[model samples]
Target: MKKTTILDLVSRKLAPFMLLFGLYLLSYGHMSPGGGFQGGVVIASGVILLFVAQGVGTTASLFPFRTLSLVEAAAFLLLLAAGLAGLAAGAGFLGNPMAGVDVRAVPRVSMILVYNVLIGLKVGAGISFVCMYLFREGR
Candidate 1:
């Protein structure tokens, strides 16, 4: 969709807030309806607002595609590493090391938060990068 300058401005202004809320969604995914993928897509929508308002070049400068790609890759790798750590620690693959973790005498949800955050970031950046590239192709 062709976004007007006003839409763009609104999106830009809302980006940070969307990001914060996305984080919240990811963190609470296990206990709620949202998750890494959902929250990441939400964050991507926020970035898309920038592209719509400022132009791809300008938005890309704000968030370089190369950096976003690297970050996405690294986040995925970190997710894998975290899982591996659980395995190495005597938990099987994809096992929850935090299964035994107690926070204030309550069992912690373990690595769910980390996974959510990483996946959210990866998904958000990856989608935003694609949209930015597509948006640039026309202009």
Candidate 2:
């Protein structure tokens, strides 16, 4: 059966907030229970809600697979580069390096925050792409 107007409306209305909350989760993951993977899944769930109600064609117009693929790759590379930076700093891969840096506001290169965001982006895009493909195939 086709989706109802209420479903469409609710999905659209709530998705932005869900996305925002997912970001919040990513940001505060170091201090709280949730983290990158959870936030990424949350963001994808919002998008998937729209996809389920609106169809892949419509969702694809807004979030094309190519764009998400690029995002996924870029996020991975960024995460990798961050890891390499830690290694170059004489720390282990993905190690925190700014704990003793003299700079006050250079972010101390908060690895937790950075990794959470990168992981969130990668996972969100990966999951979205999979769903898009499945939807396209009518699976």
Candidate 3:
């Protein structure tokens, strides 16, 4: 595929906003409709856009495969740790650890927020890695 100067420039300009939007979705997900999966897909779409506009080699250099794999692994482990912490706290697996806490002291949605962030990181890294691999294989 031939890369165009205009496509590359536009993608570079737009990618940051896509990332910011994804973060917004993850942060406010507890109060709104968007959540981990959706936000993560959005983030991955930005990277994929770069892959298409800038070529696989350039994009891969910016987002290395090793780094993406490690990030995905770490996010998954943290999610599991969160679930275990909840179980240890007697809230059941994947339940809110702060369920009994006063809402004023700490919002009841804190756990949901944490879960959203972790899941977003995991999904984003995993999808980006897979797409990067596919793009390379096509070469």
- Model 1 bad stretches (over 4 Å): 1-5, 100-107
Q: List the residue pairs that clash in candidate 3.
A: none
What is the clash tally of candidate 2? 0
Show how many residue pairs clash in every candidate, following the order shown: 0, 0, 0
lDDT of 3 by residue, 1-139 (tens): 8777888789999998998999999888889989998999999998898888887789888998899999999999999999999999899999887886667877888899999999999999999999988888445
Model 1 / residue 138 / CA error / Å: 5.8
Question: What order do you get sorting by TM-score, best first?
Answer: 3, 2, 1
Residue 57 Cα positional deviation in candidate 3, in Å, after optimal superposition: 1.5
Structural similarity to truth (TM-score) of each candidate: 0.83, 0.91, 0.92
Model 2, stretches more than 4 Å misplaced?
107-109, 137-139
Query: What is each predicted model's overall lDDT from 0 to 1?
Result: 0.82, 0.86, 0.90
Span of ten consecutive residues with least summed lDDT in model 2? 100-109
Worst 10-residue lDDT window, candidate 3 = 99-108
Residues 39-133 of candidate 2 have per-residue lDDT tens digits of 99998988888788888888889998899999999999999998888888777888876654666766664778999999999999999888888
- How many clashes would you count in candidate 1? 0
Per-residue CA lDDT of model 1 for 44-124, tens digit only, reads 887887777777777787899899999889988998998897887677887887665555754457478878888998899
Better of 2 and 3 by lDDT: 3
